[model samples]
Target: MKTYDAIVIGAGPGGYPCAIRLAQLKQKTLCIEKESPGGVCLNWGCIPSKALIGAAHLYHKAKDADSMGIRVGSVEVDPEKLQDWKEGIVKRLTGGVRGLLKGNGADLMMGSARITGPRQVEVTQADGTVETIEATKGIVIATGSNTIELPSFKFDGKQIIGAKEAVSLREIPKRLLVIGGGIIGLELGMVYQSFGSELTVVEALPDLLTGIDPECTKIVERRLLKRGATIHKNAKASGYERLADGSISVKIDQDGKQITANVDVVLVAIGMRPNSRELGLEQVGVKVDQRGFVPADKFCRTNVPSIYAVGDVSGVPMLAHKATKEGEIAAEVIAGHKAEKDWVAIPSAVFTDPEIATVGLSEAEAKEKGIEILVGKFPFSALGKAMAMNETEGFVKIIADKTTKQVLGVHMVGPEVSAMISEAALALEMAAFLEDVSLTVHPHPTLGEAFMEAAAHAMGSAIHILNR
Candidate 1:
């Protein structure tokens, strides 16, 4: 039996970073993976999807370059080449992850792992070789999540598919019907929509991107509608049928009214469920929640003190950055350092047409909690950079406490808001007041200036826009 100080299973955004940090903390860490090094986020989901989104965005820009006085003769899309380029990026990043793990002194093992005991793991390698490893200190369960498949519309991998296949399409579908108007669905649906697919979205909820700021979602929704895409809210995709001509007719139920949408592809991106089954967690006496997530405390420790869980397998806000942070905290805790899952906010970004990024409490959430608030908003149209880029579509919103003037949240929907959200997260983390950001001098004519201006607006002292 091989023995180590700590063992991390899954090797995902959560597990790899945990293993690396453990090794960096001078712990003998063994990291095990059943698939590619970077897991779904790198190999299938985030990185690949973002590559496609970028390509689609550039293609749209190039096609509409005539307005910019740059007349392009022809715009062509080579789907095969685009996929190859995206795969190249995935390969490079996964390779880097492997190199980083090895360089950080973490032993990487390619195998499927099962918890046999509180401190014991049984690993089965590709060649059918089995080995039992022992962890003296801790065992971290970072097995992320899998896309939830609706039984009504099974994944055929071609006509009907999940996010995995959605990102790897060889050719753009002429007509695409997307079920579930959440992040993954809209992001990919917009990519193909930009690629000339007639897009239709069916969302079960009353609104799109549920739990996000509705005002921010409205901007993206309006853009989709302007581009000839149809959106059905409070709707459910009841079933789908494949026709003789290789087209699919999807039946949608919205407000008790039946509607049919025929398309070349159907993407079911409702949500993801934690991958927690058959890990032998029960055998080790680790308690898993009813939703299949392993419950972990602030220190990322499970009911069994020797075991821990992080990332999607642990709880909600199933984001890669959140997983990485938890992984680092777990590693620190295992190294006898004082670290816990303590943060003011866990920021989120939706890579829609015009990205939506948010940090801390939303205006509705604050109101729901019975807290009086002051809200400030600045449109991207007011920003010179947005006008220069010809992408003036959304706005930046800042929410603060009415009494304390403390920055409660920052929500943005505009170009590059994904990258611009870090400053908002920092403000929330530092508990910055409205004046703290308002008084700071931001670079002139930048998109980020909107944040400063929004803060100033909250205090009724905005310069560019009239304070209401």
Candidate 2:
């Protein structure tokens, strides 16, 4: 048996960072991972998808460059080459994570770790060998979630697949059926759609992207429609049939009607369930809820104070950055430092064409909370930068308090808004007032100026566009 100050299970965005921080704080730490160090985000979820999205965008732009005076004959996707490039990015990032772990003096062990007691865990190696490990101070659980597979459509790892397989697909399907309209489904669907797949989105909810601002959702829906994608809301994928011609005939139910659509592949991105089962959580007295989420306090501590949980296994808003933040918090708390999960807002960015990024509250959310608010918007169509890039599909919207002039929220959907959302998150995090942003001079001919103008518009004193 080997003992350490801290033992982190699952070297994902959450676990690895926790181990590194523990080591940095001068505590002996060990991180165990069954797969890649950077977890789903680096391996198959966020990073790989973004690499493909970037390539597709570049290809699409080149193919449509006639209006920009750069005429290209034709554009095509080399799936094998693209996958190689994406894998290269993932490899570099995961390698960096490994370097960070080693540089920080954290031990990296490749195995499956399970809590055998409050301070003890058993690691099972690939060679069917089990090793006992003990943590004197804390044990951090960072195992992430897994894709929800429907009973009717089991993943064949080919024709029927989940988001994991969908991202690595080489052969571009002529027709693709995506069974969810949320972030995962829309993102991967758009990637294939750009690669020339006829897309049909079936969403069980009445609307797509349920929690986001409806106006922003509408803009994305318009873009999807323009891309020749079919959307069916309030619909359910009952089952599918494999035709003799090797195509899939998917049967969907929408409002008491049976609709059948034939496609080459089906991507099920409905949602993810927490990977809280097994690993002896219940045996160690950790409270996992009915839905499988191991609840944690603001400090990321589970019911058992000695055992902490982070990432998707911890709670909702299952973002990699969120998990990373919580991971750091848990590490610090375990190391006898003053750290807690404190933040005004955790921003969310959807990597769709033109993109949608948001932080803090929305207008509808504020109004529903019974707070009077002011809404200000500036369109990318009027921005010099947007016009120069030939991508003017969305706008910047700011929601502020009608009384105090405090900026309540910022929402944007346009080119590179994903990179600009951090500023909004900072503004909200610091509780900046509308004038604090409006009065601050933003660099000219940049997408960031929209934020300043949107703030000014909320104050009814915008410069580029009329104040509303």
Q: CA lDDT, every prediction?
A: 0.95, 0.92
Q: Cα deviation of 424 in candidate 1 (Å)?
A: 0.6
For candidate 1, write residues 156-260 as lDDT tens digits: 899889999999999999999999999999999999999999999999999999999999999999999999999999999999888999898899998889999
The sequence of per-residue lDDT tens digits that candidate 2 reaches over residues 295-376 is 9999899999899999999988999999999999999998999999889889999999879999999988898899999888
What local lDDT does model 1 show for residue 231? 96
Poorly placed runs, candidate 1 (over 4 Å): none
Clashes of each: 0, 0
Question: TM-score of predicted model 2?
Answer: 0.99
Q: How far off is residue 90 in model 1, in Å? A: 0.2
- Candidates' TM-scores? 0.99, 0.99
Weakest ten-residue segment in model 1 by summed lDDT? 240-249
